[model samples]
Target chain A: MSSEIDIKYVADLARLDLSAEQAEKLQQELGRVVEYIAELGEVDVTGVEPTAHAAQLTNVWRQDEAKSSFPREVMLANAPGIVHGDLIKVPRVLPSEEE
Target chain B: MDLKKSTIHALSRNLKDGVFSSEELCREYLKNIDNRDSEIGAFLEIDRENMLNAAKAADIRRQNGQALGDFDGIPIAVKDNICVRGERCSCASKLLEPVKSPYDATAVELLKKQGFIPFGRLNMDEFAMGSSCENSAFKQTKNPLDTSRVPGGSSGGSAACIAADFAPAALGSDTGGSIRQPAAFCGVVGVKPTYGRVSRYGLVAFASSLDQIGPLCNDAEDAGIILDAISGFDPHDSTTLPDPAGGYADAARKGAASGSLTGLKFGLPKEYFSGGLSDAVAKVMDETIAKIKALGGEIVEVSLPHTKYAVAVYYIIATAEASANLARFDGIRYGSRQEANGLVDTYYKSRGAGFGDEVKRRILLGTYVLSSGYYDAYYLRAQRVRTLISRDFEEAFKQCDLLLTPVTPQVAFKFNEKSDSLQMYLSDIFTIALNLSGHCGISIPAGIDEATKMPVAAQLMAPALGEKVMLEAAAAFMK
Candidate 1:
């Protein structure tokens, strides 16, 4: 197994950015950690079930009726930017036409 | 009364008997925080007026014969990650420095229903990702016992505050030994309840599967009181056990008061004793086991063959879950945002600027494991190994009532002693397996290390939803 990760790609997928220095630093550190955890390869897990989480229940349901919830304004209060008084605002997804 | 030496049980009785008004208790805690907190750095934020008002309201309610209950008016400081409605829930990260929870977590709501005031925001590692509080984006919380050393984290502030008597009890969430390790380092009691035992409605998710909110306090009975207030079935959290709750208080009291473990079998996992513990911790463990034997308990050696893999399994699973959970912190929503030309750039910039080094490292690792081709190799393999690890505990419990081990390999060390991330992660070996296996565990102070002179604690764990037996044995061990 190669510890040489395309950290830049992983970082991009995780919605993160790294400077040249940070990327180099993380490349080595991530290498060390990944190598350390490679010990798991030694454990033979044939026919063992995988657990996504500790939850044993399949799905939770409630009455399909509406109930009182936190006010929309309150929910949006923490939004970094808001467009309409109630809507969360964000940077545009597409590039400029000129570009 | 020396407020610093008081316990929750004693404080509750005093509040009832009017030995000190709830207002006076709050004042004492504030004074302690004002005087001692500069050195300890345990608290991140306090709504002073709100705390005082709550204390006064409790006093007025008592005067009107409407006192909430035994824990009413008693203040419980909160971990920053668990939301408290109007208070900032930073998770001690720069990214979340400005976010406030919109509502109380179910555990906080239950505590409030019991009249326990959510007093202040306690510090923790950035998103509860590190073993040392140094990863906190805000401040480094030191061990109150030895200023030169650390309060083990990511629940470092919770443990430090309790140890310093800044708060009688505190609520902390444990994913990978966050609560138990710190409680052990600070020489107080910490409980990590079985997964899903407490509702996770508003807890800032770390590793959703492994995280469970529990208490940090002076003793087993107090831990029980806090647990009783917090643990229950919740309609919102489907994972919660559908069993009836409450009665934890008496479980602990009966354990301590009975002073007899006559028929109980205490298992000592042979793996926990080998190769890792310092002499101080080893001595403390020996003494703790001797005391358990003296209390008429039978000792059995148990094998958890996969113990060696707990840290690896935990890192993969925990980081993967964390990667998914923390992805919610993209700059478009709550928390600190660094805007860029495009939405994706904004997310990258905000996260890059907001998260600390350790948190980023984990997100990257998590992303790698869960990435396309590697997913089956790392994440799936880890989950499969997690099943094996959980089975090890299930098998061990069939042989004994509960298992005992050291909380950490050694006592608290100086800040930066564990600068290496892998070493820090490895230190959680003893306590991490508990979270992985869905069992409940507690760390009770066994003794102070003669060498480090820092506190050493013994960990007692029970199989899933086994708080009663574990707390009982913990109570027995404490006595």
Candidate 2:
């Protein structure tokens, strides 16, 4: 069973804010899903290799040359906050105490 | 002549012969959308001027005797998740509400190269997370066949547009059963190519491994045409398979010409037909099977024992990857943002406000499974079982050329009918395993349920890179 605390912890890990009501609801809902998926435990997969991707692709190499990219203006057009018309702005990271 | 009922091939012929100009065709479709979209809600956004301008260009090219190909000047809708240059690619999510794509997805670019003008941005389940269009943050897309019921999703809008004649055909991405399920509900043909058969560049990430872009169209041959146009290798997406020598459209044409499937063998998994199937759908399946047998195809009983675990296995791996993939949507980037005191608050506020409930639930579930103690038990175990499911397909394929199954347990259900998330998840039971196995599948309209009059569909799945055979069989069945 997934406790409310566990659901809250997972929500934090996912960088999502859940209201107490939402967290409680998800605790019950996701607990059911988790319990259902536990059926996989009955399968014998001792020697089976886990497949991250179905396609058998290796690293594809290309010529080491610069190609055109989306224009700076176009790329920055959708940025929530921009500085100097080209750079994306973000909230400050370092704390005043660290400084 | 109602252009809405016409196929791409037929429309292409009309354009080449100058029966009417591409501009006229575009205007006609735009007018149709204006008339009908209020009720169906298929298109999330329509670029009327852009579509008109492109249609005018296609007409000019035709007048100059330099038209691109048979498909030139035909307007097609695109699911909003696929990026079109200079257009919004929202994936029907609030997080991407402010984002406009700077470039085209490789598939869309290829269609443009063929002089195909993209018509509209269709709606979908937000972030392609749910089984119904109700999960779309924007609006619910109603089933064209029955307005009271849902258009199965996350490609619900893509399928709905085609069924409503808003566009001749559309592109959709399937992770689990998004494309096929909706296609089944809407009585259109949908195809999910073998994983990596179509390039994934410019498509917003969901479950990277399970996600594939496919076409939903009125019939199998049109699906082949769209599939041929969008398929092939792109340097931008390394997972794409090298271009195959013979195109899927060509194979479909050949199969249609042959007029028989005398030597073709189709496997029917007993597990699919045994339980959870509604009588109406089973009756449709029986008729479709008989039709195939009459076409000289042989049906053999085969078992995919792990089929029962598909939905469970799918949720774990898909959500885990989604949790990781969606972490990039921080407020600092191009989506809707919420200002807050600190970085952590910004992340929380933006995501909490941006994502719908289903997306949040899946993300939380994903985070739980991939977290410290649970990784080995849930995430790793699901991955290993995914391999076992893939092997089940391999074993089944050894006995037959392709496998046949029901696309869904029943026809389209009414809005708010399946309030339970687990029940909604179970709606995709028959179609989910194909994604896990990395194979190709198509859903073609089989029949309409007598009681509800909604469409029922049958699915055909083939092994990896077996699109030609799969499409040929579909063409034969469609004929």
Highest-DockQ candidate: 1
How high is the lDDT of residue B298 in model 2? 97
TM-score of each model, in listed order = 0.99, 0.98
Worst-scoring 10-residue span by lDDT in model 1 chain B: B1-10
Provide DockQ values for all models, in the order shown. Answer: 0.81, 0.76
Q: In model 2, which residue pairs have backbone atoms overlapping below 3 Å? A: none
Q: For candidate 1, lDDT tens digit of each residue in B148-169? A: 9999999999999999989899
Q: Rate the local accuracy (lDDT) of all candidates.
A: 0.91, 0.89
Best by TM-score: 1
> So what's the TM-score on candidate 2?
0.98
Q: Which digits, one per residue and each the tens of the lDDT, describe model 2 over residues A1-99?
A: 332338878888999988999988988888778888888889899999998998978887878999988778888889899987678887766656756
